[model samples]
Target chain A: MFDFDATMPLMAVQFLLLTAILNAVFYKPLTKALDERDAYIRNNQATAKESLAKAESLVKEYEAQIAAARKESQSIVEKAQAEAREITAQKTAEAQKQVQTQKEQAAQEIQQQKETALATLEQQVDSLSRQILEKILGPELVK
Target chain B: MEILGSLTILNTFTLAELEVGEHFLWKIGNYTVHGQVFIVSWIVIGVLLIASLAATRNIQTVPGEIQNFMEYALEFIRDLTKNQLGEKEYRPWVPFVGTLFLFIFVSNWGGALIPWKLIQLPSGELAAPTNDINTTVALALLTSLAYFYAGFKKKGLGYFKKYIEPTPILLPIAILEDFTKPLSLSFRLFGNILADELVVAVLVLLVPLFVPLPVMALGLFTSAIQALVFATLAGAYIHEALEGHGEE
Candidate 1:
């Protein structure tokens, strides 16, 4: 007969029970915690990668905007300068025409004074009036 | 013979030789525990512990020969655990499962190597711990317990629900399957180790020296296989626990 002790079977059962209890108390949580930690690490890694890509793309978008703004401002300044030059040229021509008209009026008055000094004031005045009148008309103005 | 005389002297000093079965006697308050093969087994376990500890105590990164061997064994078990249970949930159980494998492995091989004949007790010869039904059954029961607890804790009452799955037609069978899992796992290991050890003992007896070498080699193989089988079942059980006993 095999040397079977009564307690031996109990010991085997106890072994089963003991290990089961140990697993319940220790192994299960240990593994659970480990798995949880692993998942957390993976999730964080994915989030990090996504955010990193987002940041990189945002930087690229900002850079493009900055470049576009620079070009737009450059064109705007160039247009404003061209407009300023045109206005300056137009004002200069207007001022020169006004000076020419003033010179012509002064010259006509000086010619009338010279005729009065030469003792033909009345005739000169008459001629001047006629000239002025004719100058108001188209043929005298052309002459 | 000379071995018996030496054992007597060693037994006088070390508690490792305290026998509890058939030979020596100790009366403690009218209860006597007999000394038989248990002492030799305890001594075997102790020696195993000491040798393993020594091998790993100052483990170098580069590893000396013994350290390398121990590391290889540990890493081998680690990989097995990783592969079977997966990298996700196999970390903590590595030590427990790996220790079980190493303990059984060393015990099995120890029986083959250390001339068991060289050690003597008053009655029967000492066999490997695995050869004893108690040890194998104990290991099997523990593994079963581990998986059961893991399953319960992981999936809770839903784990039991898994047993009543497949449209309830296979409920009874599933329950039976759950019960048989531990029995099969335990018996498989016990049967293999016991048979291998018995065969080797018989062969050694039949032929004193030469013919037993091959059987000894076979014993080594059996030891490794049993260890792997035990670990594999443990990993499978853990996997089942993680997945739960769902319909699939």
Candidate 2:
């Protein structure tokens, strides 16, 4: 029917009431649930991203330290080898100089001993010839 | 003689002559209300309330069957508001638009589904609340008020300034459209629902068996379409009122 009367206002009021009630029970809760799930997903993704970045940085730092340590150890071993070689060469040179001085002293001692022995033998021979001449001339000169 | 014989057929043809303008009037405080509209509408509202409460009581991230369907339906309604009213301004008006769609949708399908013939009325038989012109008029008037409220609230008194813009010549025509908006909204719903009911009734009277099934199915489709049309138009009107220009 085309009648308006009280029905119009009443229907309006009823619809408004229905809207209010439905908003409370239906729209609000559903939106909340959906938004909650969305936020949870976004939060989890952020956490995962942060953790991955941290782990990557840690791995990089560890690799750099290992590289530095390997270089340091290699330099230490090379330095020790250089020191040992220098010491060995210096000791060999000192031992060769001492041997040369000892050989020269031994040669001088042998030359001096040979000269003393030759002089003693020559004095003995001269003394024996003079005694034999005196014994042969002694009797006639006295008569 | 032939008239009398045809009158017998007319009598037997309908369950009750389509009570086009009839209402079981209730007198309340110097005002008469349509009782049948309220009766069926209350039932529709009660069903909506119960189903809504049941589905949403134990709200979970993991949805159940009824809850899933209800969410899909509500999401569809939200999308309608968003597309019509634009994105930022749509959230506030969801309740208003959702109520119109659900109320009309439920009422129309209720009229089509409920066996109101079994429970007879004293004056006229029971039907959908939308079958009454008064109810549609009330809903259309609310829509007009809503758009006007949205415009006034959003744009302040500048809302009325659009009437004379581009020229003052179209002011009267623009004002005339305000009246026609409600008229068209009410009549479209009332006419379609009433026609569908009459057609289905006639078919059932003629064949009363398998013949009415397809028409009934079509009636369901029309019911849903009408509900969507009403809600979408309501949102569009509000959208227009809130916009800066009417030159388009």
Candidate 3:
């Protein structure tokens, strides 16, 4: 059997060397990569959450705009209908005024014609009487 | 025939004394290497790597038996590391810590289970490398180096600052403590496994009855505990490296 006293230091040195080499080559890079990967994932998750929130707010804004537009359009339609009814009422009143004026003129014209006709008839009757007296007197005087 | 049979049983339980470098047949110039241990360690590591790879090869949602068992193991180690080191820093160390725990655990158990004598390689005997102080020390050194490097890299000159921090009154003791950390880490594993192996060998020779069974069970328990201790300390070291002199 070999003596333990002789080999102890050699063993220690070898172990120390092995650990140093291994840590440099293997351990450090692996850990750094892992850390980077974790950071990337965290960043991605944060971005996704932000986008999702933005999209949700955008949807709400669109819905609000649509609602406001619908309300405005409904009010516009109501105003137009009121204006049309007012115009129709104004035209009907004007037409009624014209008919009243026409009716009064026609009545006046009829009354005037009747009066003229009466006067003419009286004149004609007077003429016929005169003619009849002349004819009777002339025959008597000549006899 | 009974006598021969008893001799065979005696042989079966015998522990062979093998030299570290005796099995090495290759001589490159003046140097002789323990090709057996190298080959054995290689085999242990390779087999583990290959088996685990195979287990994970085509991962199934509703896994096959092997995949289920392996995934369970991997997840278990992952949880342990996560608990010890916290999730953020623990991810990178998972494969290393996982492999270390598994390799050690498998090797320790392999030493107990695989009858090296039966294989009869040209080598005197073969066992799990972790059973040896050299291999365990290597493992400990690797862990020490890991945390030390982590501390240095994470804090630079501040790594030394930690040795003297809180108060100058504590500096010398802290330095000594830092020096002893790896020693403790290495010996803790080596001492436990060596003792367990020795006890099993002794018990098999002395009392071949129900005694060795309990001892073997204890050995298994110790093996697992040792692996856990090594892994936990390694995790704590990494935590200390990253955290520095902060309050827990």
Candidate 4:
């Protein structure tokens, strides 16, 4: 068992040959595949992160646009309400002025009719009084 | 004496006998090799190759089961190498360290799990490649050579300056460490694996029942730890060489 012989050198040669064969068939290609897989995963992760950032930014932009549109629409509604209020006030004032002018014209016509009737009644009363006096006294004696 | 004599007689009746320090030798052009080690080692290597091919056949960005397992293993080895050698120098040495870990881990586990005794051998039965001293020594020597090569390549002749660092009187000790490194590495693996196998074999011979189950499990655990220890030490040695004496 302790004997040292030519087997040692030949076994060494065989081991070297095995090493060479393993290097060619095993180590080189396997390492290459591992590296390629690593790179592939890393690449996918990077792109995924990039797209996520883009989506977040787009969400923020759309939200801002929506907020601005809401403010603009609110202001437009308020402006329309204010304009309607102003037009209603103007129309109401114009209608009140026309009603006041019609009332003044009707009062003037009633006053004119009353004055003409008073004047005619006074004339009729004078004629009746004169006739009554003539009938009561004798006409030849008084003359 | 009577009990001992009777125990010897009882041992022969067991299903399998304890085998130690035996080998199936095959003659090459001018050298003899352990045929059993080679046979199991080829099986281990074939398993590794098939698993690797299946994992890598349909490579995709989104990995399936086999691909995921292979990637996990690769990542583990990368982290181990990086921790030892630092970021700058770990890339080149990942394959070497990973190969050592995988080979030793598989060999040790295969030795424990496979029923090599069932297959009758002419001489010695098959075992883990690492159970043999030759194989561990070869692995340790390779680690030594790798570190030395790394040091030389990175620092050139300046690598030798580490022996005299702090004081020249420590030169002999530093040089002695080089010899001890490989010696300890090889012996640690060989002894642990061989001892585990022996314990299991002895238990199986004695009881031949469910009694050896826990020890077999323990053997498997130790086998994995031994593989880890060997790989970690080898990586540390390489890192030490690459770091040089400049920092110290």
Per-prediction TM-score, chain B alone: 0.77, 0.91, 0.84, 0.93
Q: Which order, best to worst by DockQ? A: 4, 2, 3, 1
Candidate 4 Cα misplacement greater than 4 A, ranges: A106-143, B1-16, B246-248
User: Rank by TM-score, descending?
Assistant: 4, 2, 3, 1
Candidate 4 per-residue lDDT, tens place, A1-143, comes to 78767778988998999999989889989988888888999999999999999999999999999999999999999999999999999999999999999898889988988999889988988876666666677555434
Query: Once superposed on the true structure, which residue ranges of model 2 sit more than 4 Å away at CA?
Result: A52-143, B1-17, B246-248
Error of 3 at A132 (Å): 91
Please, what is the whole-model Cα lDDT of each candidate in the order they appear? 0.64, 0.86, 0.67, 0.89
- How do the residues B1-248 of candidate 3 rate in per-residue lDDT, one tens digit apiece? 24433544666555433333335344556554444445566666556656555665555445677656666676677787898789788877776676567767877777767666566667435766565666677777677777887788777977888766678788889878777887787778777876776676556656656788888788888888888888888888878877777555
What is candidate 4's DockQ? 0.71
Residue by residue across B1-248, what tens digits does model 1's lDDT show? 34434554544333222122233333446453333334544565466455555555554434577655655565687788898788888876776676567657766777667766566665645656665555666677677777787788777887777766556888888778767877777677767766776566445444446786787787789888887888788888878777765424
- Report, for all candidates in order, the number of backbone clashes: 4, 0, 7, 0
Q: Model 3 compared with the native: what TM-score?
A: 0.59
Q: Model 4 Cα displacement at B203 (Å)?
A: 1.3
Task: List the RMSD of every prediction in angstroms.
Answer: 12.8, 7.3, 9.2, 3.4
What tens digits encode model 4's per-residue C-alpha lDDT throughout B1-248?
24433554677545445556677888898888888889999898888888888889999888899989988989988998898888999999999999998999999999899888788888877889999999999999999999999999999999999999778999999999999999999999999999998888778767878999999999999999999899889999999998876574
What is candidate 3's TM-score for chain A?
A: 0.65
lDDT of 4 at B15: 48
Clashing pairs in 1: B19-B35, B20-B34, B20-B35, B21-B34
Error of 3 at B136 (Å): 1.1
